[model samples]
Target: MREDTTVSALDSLYLANSIFEGKLLQAAAKYPFTVSNFFKSFDDEPLGITTSADGVLIIYWWDTLTGGTQHAYSCVAQYKTAHGIKSVSPASPNKYSCSYSKIYSLKSKDKIYYLAVYDEILSYHDRCQGIQIFLIDKDDLMPAKLIKTQTGLHSKIDYLYNDNSMRDQNWENELTYHEKTQTLTIPVALENGNLTDNYITYKFNGEYFIKLKSK
Candidate 1:
């Protein structure tokens, strides 16, 4: 690449970073984000954004230090910065760490639901996965409320399995949140070392997501 072209690209990236940082900082003021348990030295720009039907905006982001990366979800709607934070995840030599995947959201009748799927990596094949469901009240735009958490969830997309592992289910499948039906569906492993042909579906009752028949 030419020198000017490279410089222009770098400039664009910097500009984008600046804009995102300013927006996030402004949003954090009124609705303070819950800091990670493992303190971070710096964080990255918002990875993505998901908005509810009612116009509530939630951002997915992560921060890191020498130890590990911690991800968070934040709302942006006339907020002040709750605290000051750095803006980069320093390079680390270690491989084993805990991190979250891209956040997902589902809009129900009057509320928006968020999902955080996390993995704790101990080694190449030794890891534990979990899921946390959150509900944000659109009326107030307050911090998300934790509704439920489930551990030991398997991930075909993020995991590497042996060649002899069951292949009946589509390993490329991911969780699907249907807006029209207000349903969430994903494949589940059976006790017999096989995956269900039909993906299991869940619906939000008054309190939490309840398992419904597979679609």
Candidate 2:
């Protein structure tokens, strides 16, 4: 039993390595992909990077298996002195059947806030359900302290109703950021059948998110 457990652990590690390497290489090609353009190819977009004066922080989704349950999780990697990119922390502690898809940085004076977008597992791909907002110190990137959480946002495709008739039919409830205005737009579903009719905008006030009136 002991030997079997050890072998299983080794196998799990190997699987994680193989999965992450392929996904990382695939995602690395689109380095520094901005938040607005990311949701356009949301399924294919697996990695997000946030850079600071200190170093670069990367967050990518790597699938893993544990006890016969497969996990699509977000993993953290950072640039080292001469060692290149290395994993600095464990996978995000998301509940089973949930995974983080992308990370966005909101610079507020001396602070940088990381907004991690995550979704419930209805399929193998990333279809946003909500967001987890957090931040990390520029000097130390291990612990990503969560500041806020917002739910009930849907980026799922309406396969039954959507057949490409409407513009952005696939991404009805998408999240986007306007760098010029420093505004983060979150699409929230107002009515059951009304896909993308309502939205909420927010701006980082150097400490927390301040809701802005709809314009």
Candidate 3:
């Protein structure tokens, strides 16, 4: 995460989302797509860059907005090279999301994954307490098929919501990575006050790092 932001962390995200609104619009226009009959998908919008030994793949996130608010986030991938555009990943909405796409590579740099985890800020009371994980594939930059998680991973966003105004940073990963094991460990609090040192772990599968267990 970029810690240099003088303002709050999520505030940095919120600011980024707002600041790049124009770029988003332009990206959406560049690759027009429709998600469903009811929604216009922006899965083609390039919001991230993937650096892999295989090659550079541009990442895209389509924000489905309704009534001036984001309803869904769709991910897409584009293959790039000096000669020309080599290929394009599926226009389909993969798990592409992240305030900023942080790429984690395995033994090979080209073989990697993108991570996006965010706390549901608009949630009212505890109804919206949890961090949403959207993991994207290295090849497609689309949502990986193996893993996705929502709750039991983040400390709840409670009454202090209004007090903080910008929200809490509990959603951030308190991490431990095992090189040989290829595991990412994140310590989070339970929602119902079950445990304070609850740890959720993800093991890198062949394609993605899926949630292994929590305790």
Candidate 4:
């Protein structure tokens, strides 16, 4: 690309970063978010920073004591130059606890970013089920659009959660993600077991992650 084109793209990225940072900082002040305060309230610590495909950063921490309810990210929203954290989340109850939660960035197309926030809890036996997948548009970084704030996968157009046989039963006992194909593969049990040798690949389809195929 030409120097001017490169510089213009950089400028656009910088502006987006600035807008997102300011929005988060204002939210922090209004929400009164702080590392000390978060640790005090929930006893959660910093989980580290993750950047999206659009240079948007989000800091995730584990959730605990949800009691079979939805949880939210303990602390989040950040920038390279400064960190903007909100102590609270508008997520479903107990959705983001530390016991069984995983957050990571998926593949990016253009300036858009896709984030996977997996929330799971064991309702009955030692087996953990009820896995929830969330996607985010990191560029916006707004409460209304930070996370899709919905249930199940394949949010729009198609529904992957219902397409699979594990709908009524549960997601699985465990989940695995492959970075090469940008697919989250979860093992589905064959008979009366937690997981079988066979697996299912959940791939992102721009809007939501869907069941690309099974093996």
Candidate 5:
């Protein structure tokens, strides 16, 4: 890459970081939360910290256990830059009972933050089930309307109902907003289909309304 191209990419990243930081800071002023724990899990030091985007500081932690299962959680919190924390609000507990990998994304736009999660479940029968995109607005924390949910089996897995079955379920439990198209896309896949690369995309306006959908 040329020097100018590199510089431009750096500038874009810096601007995005700045916007997220500003959101976190603002959230800190209102709620004021802090990290209360950090411990070693499965040989990895899992640290908890307060992060912000558009002045909203979000508290989160990630840990890996013996088996390949990774546990993680995040909640909106009040940030106090001086004291490091002010307080934290209680978030509704959510539990997923499946062997799967998860990813999260936070998108800041139009003065509101969007949250999304993607989960890929690998069944014992060699089947795969995916939840494309699930989303919630920062202000309400209520899940937005269901964009799309899909499930199927991978090709290598012959019998779809061999002792274990890949039931079509809501797996994409993560979300993030797209700045260019003002859309939210959550990564997802099917268990029986040859969909190694599939995603749920939603287009919305500033008023927090869904207008379009695509895979």
Candidate 6:
């Protein structure tokens, strides 16, 4: 595992060629798989990787910083069997101008994955935080839905804003969906171990979002 001090430590990490190239090359040689170059341009943080149901690997390039109201681009290679390169495609092109920092390929009945993004604001003497999420189908790579809202301030001060207002703020958030119970859970925890949980049950007809609260 390689580490760098570029963006925040929360900035994702990518596997290096020297680390996984041997195993990947061995997999390609033994199995009927292809290898292609995956490329993208950004602040050079870590890259995300996940496998499809058919054993195809999907790589995601995540940008740590919110690009000043600009959208970041990602490119992925979908390999074909017989160990040959086939095609390259865009993950999210011209969708929205936000930061998708975390990507997860879900193993659920609905066959979908999720990307979590957020807008961060740091005070001179306080903590920084933000929020954004996306749900897309695994097969088509089409965005099923998106949530671009802020949470709340993360500082030492006890200042209060419009609690009922629906504007974006900065806070910690997580997204996950359960296949068996068809439930999505977003549990928020603070520094004191106080926890709040929010749940959403899905029928898989379409995409949906659930609010998370931190105690």
The lDDT values for all models are 0.42, 0.47, 0.40, 0.41, 0.36, 0.35
Model with the higher lDDT, candidate 2 or 5: 2
Q: Residue by residue across 1-215, what tens digits does model 6's lDDT show?
A: 78764775323322333234344434533444333333333226355544344444443334434333342333343444343433334333233422234333444455444433322222222222222222332333344443312453211111111222222535433444455543344444344433334322222333333333333
Off by over 4 Å in 3: 1-98, 107-111, 124-140, 148-181, 193-195, 205-215
Residue ranges of candidate 4 with Cα displaced over 4 Å: 1-90, 93-101, 124-173, 190-193, 205-210
* TM-score to native of every candidate shown: 0.41, 0.50, 0.38, 0.43, 0.39, 0.34
* Local accuracy of candidate 5 as per-residue lDDT tens digits, 29-69: 44332232222341354333433333333443322221133
Candidate 1 lDDT over 117-143, as tens digits, reads: 445544333343444454433333232
lDDT tens digits, residues 155-188, model 3?
A: 1111112213225545443445565787766665
TM-score for predicted model 5 compared with the true structure: 0.39
Instruction: Give the local distance difference test score of model 6.
Output: 0.35
Model 4 CA lDDT for position 183: 69
Error of 6 at 25 (Å): 18
Please give the clash total of every predicted structure, in order. 7, 0, 3, 11, 37, 7
Off by over 4 Å in 5: 1-44, 48-50, 64-76, 79-86, 89-93, 97-111, 114-176, 193-195
Q: Residue-wise lDDT of candidate 2 within 115-148, one digit each (tens)?
A: 5555544333323355555555443444333332
Error of 3 at 81 (Å): 5.7
> Model 6 reaches what TM-score against the true structure?
0.34
Task: Name every residue pair that clashes in candidate 3.
Answer: 42-62, 94-143, 95-143
